[model samples]
Target: MRGFGDLEAEIMDRLWSWGRAATAREIVDDLQLRRPLAYTTVTTVADILHTKGWLRREKVGRAWVYEPTCTREAYTAQLMHQALETTSDRAGALLHFVDRMSGDEASALRAALEQVKERDTP
Candidate 1:
């Protein structure tokens, strides 16, 4: 239910954006373009992410390749849900959230709600 740390977020962002499994070395290399990072540091954080169930990994040759267990969108939803849970008035919080949405985002939310409503109708 908790969010990722700085390096953890960096690693997850790379894997999600890449849309494929990647070894820690590949992540480290990509991160190096933005800032210096050690391979071992990335590997250790990746292992932590795996343990935390945010990532799935498999041994490929001598390295462990990692991929996200959920999409970035799913993660965003979970964080939003968690934020709502922290408020005493969920409805009020949601109203505030809706009020801040742009026109396109509001339209998408309405469309998604309609789909859910149609699916739930019995």
Candidate 2:
């Protein structure tokens, strides 16, 4: 899928951070604290997100409640995969990334790898 526009990204951020289905009014209210935005603007963006398949909404009390179709982590993983695809030497790039990880992150990666190995052992 294509990346989001600035306003669209902000709208998604609000949905992911809110961690619940929310009406356009709620998103607009949250965003308004940073700057002014009209309710229709938010509503339009939410509808656009729904059309893009990034959000799904249901009608509730004459208003549409929107929520992300994918979790932030899932989106993040897709972006990371996309980044890796740009490199000619994927393995070398991944290795370099691993080499730069903090100690705790490295430990977690090692533990995750071990779990995968165990699962594959039958």
Candidate 3:
């Protein structure tokens, strides 16, 4: 998962929601919650994502359609790994992660641990 600025996250969300491909104009219209974005801004972000390997683009007539190359789960795992990499103290980071997690995240941690244990069983 790549680390995204808030706008990038919203852009990725729009692409992921489609699960196919969308033009920059489509993305700008979709993310109207923050503020309406210029098509050029959307195009720039899509270009960045493509260059960073986070997005794939296909030619569609005069425009390129962009889609997320990574799934939401994969993106999240990558982001988590990146965060962990930046922490100087692994233990402290883990504790902070646990402490700051919402209930759902805590539960997801429990589920992941159980799955890991299950995989370790003979």
Candidate 4:
């Protein structure tokens, strides 16, 4: 899977933060706070994300509203899996990654693993 470009990431961040479908105009207005961006530019990027299957769009009134197809957690997990695939020793890489996690993150990882274990144990 292709990674997101700078603009794509920014747009996705806004959509995720908004937690709902948003129009190109709304996204442009929100993004303009950080940098000057044209409405068409945002629209083009949103369309690209839709083409990439990272976002879904619907016709709301005369405008297209876009929202993430998956949650942020799912995206993060995909990235982690991709990173792991790059290494020959997946177990060592994961151990090193776990060693670097903060206390809270480690606890969350443990809990998430337990939940997965329980779900898999038919």
Best by TM-score: 1
Decreasing TM-score order of the candidates: 1, 4, 2, 3
lDDT tens readout by residue for model 4, 1-122: 65789999999999888899999999999889989998999999899999999999999889999999999889989998899899999999999999999999999999999999999999
Candidate 1: C-alpha RMSD after superposition:
0.8
TM-score per candidate, in order? 0.96, 0.86, 0.78, 0.96
Model 3: how far residue 81 lies from native, Å: 1.6
Each prediction's Cα lDDT score? 0.94, 0.93, 0.86, 0.93
Q: Against the correct fold, how does model 1 do in TM-score?
A: 0.96
Q: Model 1, stretches more than 4 Å misplaced?
A: none
Please say which candidate is ahead in lDDT: 3 or 4: 4
Best by lDDT: 1
Please provide, for model 1 over 1-122, each residue's C-alpha lDDT reduced to its tens digit, 9 standing for 90 to 100. 88889999999999989999998889999999999887888888999999999999999899998999999999999999999999899999999999999999999999999999999999
**37-75, model 3: which lDDT tens digit per residue?**
788888898899899898999998998988889898988
RMSD of 3: 2.5
RMSD (Å) of each candidate, 1 decimal: 0.8, 1.8, 2.5, 0.9
| Alpha-carbon runs more than 4 Å astray in model 2 | none
Q: Between prediction 2 and prediction 4, which has the larger TM-score?
A: 4
TM-score of 2: 0.86
Off by over 4 Å in 3: 32-34, 120-122
